[model samples]
Target: MLQKFQVNLMASKLLWTIFMGLLIPTSYSVFFNTTTLLEWSLFSISSTPIMLTLILDPLGLMFSCSVLMISANVLKFSTIYMKEDKFINRFTVLVLMFVLSMNMLIFLPHLMMLLLGWDGLGIVSFILVIYYQNPKSLAAGMITALTNRIGDVMLLLAIAWTLNQGHWNILHMWMLDENMYQVLTITLAAMTKSAQMPFSSWLPAAMAAPTPVSALVHSSTLVTAGVFLLIRFYPFMSSAWWFTPLLLLTAVSTTLMAGLSATTECDMKKIIALSTLSQLGMMMAAMGMGMVHLAYFHMITHALFKALLFVCAGSFIHSHMHSQDLRWMGNLANQMPATSSCLVMANLALCGFPFMSGFYSKDMIVEASMFYQHNLLMVTLMLVAMGLTSFYSTRFSLCVVWGTNNCNPYIYLEESNPLTSPMLTLASMSVISGAIIMWVAPLKQEMMLIPMYQKLMPLILVLLGASLAWLISATKQKNESMLMQTQINHYASCMMWFLIPLSSQFPMKLPMYLSHNYLKLMDQSWLEALSGQGINSLSVKSSNILMSASKPMPVNYLMMSSMLGLMIMMVMF
Candidate 1:
């Protein structure tokens, strides 16, 4: 019965994948051939006058199509990746729920309705992050859920503040007065979900989840939620003075931090997770620069290759008896040819190698940054981040694909169709999606005359980064002193400069300390003494005293004396 159920579930997912494949072309038509906005009203509350509105435009259509496409592939991958687990059916349901939530977020335009989907994503992600039922998974789930909850709170506040405008639908409120607080709140909320600086610990910690979950959540659905929200809310924010510089700072910091951390990470999954963070930063940076379309384009391309990277990494883990440490992974190109090839392709795309998926969007973002008159420091940081991206991608490739083979002799290292199939599908997209998006949804670039070197700055950075990585990889094997120094330097990088520990600890400890004090001083001492145990003890002591006093008097004698006194009193009256 169990086997039959699993088979049926897999079939359902496969059908969904086919449906999504068809929907992609439909989405392309809607994006390029149609300009009409579709809307439907679910219901409206007359009291507070909040309307639940669903709006589908080209942007939403594009995002929805991407979500469905990636989701279908993830579900298909899960069928094989999670086949050995006892609760595979439950996992499938959670993934489908996650997809549904993302769809709701994509399709809905009302702040009230979007909240439903936003909150759903947060709650469902928490459940999925903790799906493994272990301490680490539980801790990660807490971080993931709590970090996202901050965003949820911000959205709720935005919704509440916007109630004064008498409409919950942001699309309908074009002329509504823009509130800086609301916009800032929403932007910060988006930052939290995107795992920007100060809230980035949860992204890597969330790798405790199963890899298929990682592939889905980190790549297309969960992390992108913030970027999508910003894209939708961009109109209201474009003119805000603080919006650009704030977003620029957050994005550049997150990009640099994540890239540096990725370079030092030895855990294969964490490296991929940090790379996702870095890419998300790029997307956010583009949005910050007032290029929503470019950010959206990069977002779609990143989703394709990042998901492929996670699936490939997952395959490696499964083959290597669940070990994710990169030190144990080496020369996989020989043993697992298909998986290794996919890894290389994804890494190359991540590094923004010429003409690849990342190049099409990332190159434009770099160029756009240069074309704008921005702060020199911010631009330099962005360029350095581009370099670090290539540096880390090459480092990861060297460690996992071409390093020494360290697997146990008896362990089988072979790629299965279930794993490689989804990877190949995504790899194909990784090759072509960039070009297609550029052709179909091209961003209008400003005409500027500049030196050839400026146009090729991103490529130049890539070469410099790749060369640095090669030098490090080549020399580390021969130089013990250099390796030691590298390790010393890596201490800060590997610990993410204590960002995770400090963020996790401060938030966790402050609340815990307050709770402990509340428990000890209020619940255990004051409240108990005044309301609960103290009152009970006082009543019990009073009753005991009354009983002891009454026992000293005889009932009959007391009654007779009382009667005599009553008669004397009546005569006197």
Candidate 2:
């Protein structure tokens, strides 16, 4: 139908219209400090009420608006990006469902109702990740699905645990007592969803998906669901003494891992995916420092710029005939000016440059780190991770966008308005959204006291990271001299400290090995001896013995003599 009518682009227009329709009210909700609580009992089960509860608040509405805006642009972008795919309709529907699931997670206050979105993300993400229908996509999809399944189970456990409270609304769970297990599960669920530490492998592997799915999943929908869940549950989960410390460790480790991984990665989409992971760590770090609002603010800002970054990256891939390796992407600046320009701004925003979208929230979090009392080691790691963020972003931009021509000099690179317009829209947001949100959003005013040096720490880290990147880029001679060392470090970094294998193959290998051994022990050994083979052997031996009796008449005679003897004994009695 889309092929016949060419309204392949109309869905995005409709979505954009809805976005414009809701933007005013959502902004009003933010400015006027308005929130609405809506509750309706859907049904009763065994004296328990199943309710559909929605929170029409600044945060929910604002986030919903962001999701719609990004989705609309992504859909428009996909019309051109996926123009040649045979199953474009299927892809469009899947993307719509993905957006719907995220919106559900954003608004629903009820835990049970929230699961509809939470699990929907997991299921739909797996499908999108493997949409290419290849072994690599399948493997990546498996890692993504299994890792998220951990969070899904944790969420379900939280819902079951809270069922005893007679209400499933998470809004009121803050006052309830003895929520230790509940908070722990909620934290675990959030960590896995956001791809922190042990669950970090899937985020990068999910780059096997199409660039559009990566734009959505890495930006706001799938990966952000965890942080969003944590934000919602923060009121109750923060009561635990260990909450901050746990998240602190998770954030630092994940940031370090992703930053290092991005520096060495050659795949364009994976590089951006790793950046998303690093930003998520920053968000988690903010929450860990007891700055929940800062974390949420960072999440929102990150979503905008990250989505923009992915769209720009997607355009690069499309121009190069779907080549995503950074090594093959240089000299694109002159060939594709619009994409190159948007890519530069996206990277700038990602680095949290002054006045960019990321600066408002990210800089606050950086300062708050100094104000908070997380141990010396945690603070150092956090600062180092921030520096690494800038380093990788700079390194990536230097390698892919501004480097010398690495591909065919005469290759055609198309930059249509339909393609460039989405990046332009998101790029504008990436620039101005931070300042607008800072002025409009009514965040709690925290009185922060820090020395001038401490206040400059984040900027200093950014400068330092960029310097290191430039230094390395200029020092290629020394790097080439230590080729073996360079190769070793690159391999390790590309493997993400061996996390990719551990998460993807280790889980599969161990289970398969164990099942193989179990088969050898049970089916091949004991079961053969005690059940089928053993029974067969016994019956065979007995049959042979009967056949060895020489004749059927001899066996019949023996049976008759035994029966006659028993009859004589009965008569004597």
Candidate 3:
């Protein structure tokens, strides 16, 4: 009966997930109309509205919607994706955990609950990352998990700082604080969680997981956790003088770095992986500039387009016997029409093509940046990032979909096979999802613009980027070099590394470097040394010291005599 209950609980969780996605929206329609009842959950018990908040704020609504939709879709995909895998039960459990955590995260009001959700999300992601449990994949998962844990620590410090300042209940109340320590800690937490700067390396490594895992977790949900955190804590971030500039610096560095790295990547997944980071950096920049809504709006659209891109890439890989190298892939449009079409649509969204969901959010961010102080430089850097974004997105789509027909000699030796109908279905949804996002209201704010041409700047950047990409690719088609490719792949890293020398001038540089590399090594070494000598050393030293200061123990007869003497004395008393 207990075993049955566990089964029931697990099954019910999935049903709850479906309800959270579909039934909640239906419930909203009803609750807004005829229902006088207010259904309270843990979320309600914690949430206190001090500002002009909707019954459900737009950010929460959009995020919850995305959470349900993608999770449901991922569940559908995973039913097949994990079919042959031995760890299916564990996979399902983690997926359920991820869904539950993400839902709670969107609705969480206090910092404590938000941290709980954040850690839960991290655990689920780590489990998903190492699902197969191979050495390389486990290493990848551990690195990401460890890095995220570091971010969590900084976040905890920030929370303590906030509570000390008497911002006890409302974590979102940022401007109320005048503390600089709180500001630095929070900024550090955000940048690390978002995988900005040196922390960005783990994301590409995370592509070692399954394709569905990559699509939903890395591309859409997990990688966006930091960005979402920024959106949630936007009020607090703006209160800090150092916050915006730091955020902007990280954003630009990451954007440029990821773009350059995307160029050199051979694995299809890593290219998309780097691209996700680049796009996320841009979103972070927008958030730092006080465009909270715009940041989340882009995050939503990015989830749609980037997820589709990954699913499509997965289909491409599955079709060709799990080959992830784009260089070996060519002329797939003729063979995998569904996938090609979907790739094209997602690319359009990614390139910020006009009327697409990508265009809407990207424009809002750019507009926010324009309104930002020092608009010219920020906008230019963003525009440059935009160009890189377009170039990489286009390159990713085109190389796999319509590049040269000739397969590499190495690939031909392996004799790759074509994809199946299931793969085609996966690709189909990715394409259709992009179109679906256009109808999502918060992101489709084109009508709210001040003037038609006011929005033209972002469009112009998109055009310039696309045109330059076309020109570069065209030139490359004449003579593509492996050297150029190598440089392009390492472009993001080079930029990040460039910061290391500059960072050397700061007082914290040595500690940061040691913490990043040597501290963990020393920690393990210390543990080993202590463990090896601990028991023997304690036994020898304590026993010798005690013996030197004490007499030998009395025999059993002496103990008996002492007891008799005590009894006699008691009798006398």
Candidate 4:
């Protein structure tokens, strides 16, 4: 019976994946009210859809579709990816938990319930990331875990602040009042979760996990949690006057920085992971600038192509005996034709080539960014970011598909179905998804594409970037930078000096730095530090003193003599 129970876990996990994938479209089909010919009078028709009403907006539907599609592919891929692993049972359970949690997160009506689902998803990702139990992988898992917690803290603070202002119901919350604080808190939280700018390094380190984990968590669902939060709370976000401008600034900077890193990165997974961060930053910028449609479009397109790239990379690794570094790979297009073709198509979508899904939404985001405030520097930064995105994206393609091969003898290519089928499915989606989305939702009427000259800029940047990256690769100029070397050395030193020690010294330095300035900023603006700390300490100390005094006292000879003397005096009286 125990063996049978263990045997059934995998099937149960897979079943849940299928169920989650179908739940959204099924719900939408059943609940979409079409009475009175789609648009009635000022007061539209009434509909009471079960749970679907929680997050039934167009943006919500887009994320629902993304979560479903990615969860399905990850589950199928895991079946083959975890076949030989010892912790398959645990891995399968966490995968199912992650899927169910994310599905619940988008539909949660109450803020607390939404947070519950959000934190659950993060926890499951952390567990899955460390499934290999290697030293470096464990460290990577720790980094992701801590960063996620920091993001959660900001969200919790925002929720508490909202509740303090007597706004427990999000629908009734007003953004025009003193809601700027809440907006800032939520924005900070979202940026951290999405791996924007200074908080971006964690995603690349997360590549230490197995390919399936990276494909599902980093590329598909987990990193997008912040964007989902922003989209879900768009009404409140739109209320903040400064929020859009700030988001635009951060997005442009994050995209450019991540793009630069991606150009020099050699790790196959790391390059895609960084690019995902950059792309997500652009999505946030779009949403912040009131381009929700463009944001949703880009999110859908990014999910398809990023997942395809990760899955195809997995296939390449499985075929080439676990080699993930792009520098040592060359001419794999001829060797793994199916995998190569999928990779090329996926990369094309990422590059925003003509007629691809990425070209539609990505161009929309850049255009929207340009229209908001129209700062020349921000526009230039965004353009440079586009070029960087193209440069690194092309670098990834060149190394994996067209580079020289140093044949490793121990590598054993997996059987075709194990490596090719799932990848082909993802790759096909990468190609077809853009067309389907374009047909389903035309952005021309919604976003108003940028002028012809403006559109030409990104294309020209793309061509220039691809050419520059190819030259860099050909010239053998790729080397680790001083900053990167310092980071690697610092992390190495920590593991060697502190992690090896017997004491419980935590890896809290990074967390401290991120939380410090923000906490200080909050304290200065809202609460006083001395009073809060003093009151808390005083309450604790007084409670301890009262507790000590409440202990029972012993009665001995001294008490008895006093009682006897008192009794004699009373008798005399």
Per-prediction RMSD in angstroms? Answer: 5.2, 4.8, 8.2, 10.3
What global local distance difference test value does model 2 have? 0.86
Q: After superposition, how far is residue 441 of candidate 2 from its true place, in Å?
A: 0.8
The true-structure Cα RMSD of candidate 2 reads: 4.8
Residue 298 of model 1: what lDDT?
92
lDDT of 1 by residue, 273-365 (tens): 999998998998888788788898899999999989998998989888889988887888888889899899998899898989989999888
* Model 3, TM vs. native: 0.74
Give the alpha carbon lDDT tens digit for every residue of 1-573 in model 4.
Answer: 333466323553555467577555645643552111121122222331112224444445556666666766666776676677766666766776886787677666456557877899778878877877899889878877877788889889887777654534445567657677888888888887887755665677788878877887765578887887787777767877888888878887777767766655667887888788789878876775677767877888888888888888887776666778777777887777887888888888888887777888887677666655677887788788888788777778887788777668566655466456667766777777777776765344354555788767777888887887777767665533222347664443323222222111245556677789778776653465456675566656855665576554455445545765786588579
Off by over 4 Å in 1: 1-4, 11-33, 42-52, 175-178, 446-448, 478-489, 529-573
Worst 10 residues of 2 by lDDT: 476-485
Q: Which residue pairs in candidate 3 collide? A: 174-236, 257-492, 264-488, 264-489, 319-419
Worst 10 residues of 1 by lDDT: 478-487
Local lDDT at 484 for model 3 = 54
Angstrom error of the Cα, residue 221, model 1: value is 0.7
In order of listing, the candidates' clash counts read 0, 0, 5, 1
lDDT score for candidate 3 against the true structure:
0.67
The count of residue-pair clashes in candidate 2 stands at 0
lDDT of each: 0.83, 0.86, 0.67, 0.70
Q: Name the lDDT value of residue 485 in candidate 3.
A: 51
> Model 2 segments beyond 4 Å from truth?
1-7, 175-177, 447-449, 477-488, 524-573
Per-prediction TM-score to the true structure, in the order listed: 0.89, 0.90, 0.74, 0.77
Model 3, 347-463: lDDT tens digits are 887878876667767866776566546557766887788877777777776677778755643432111122233334434543454455444443434344345565687787777
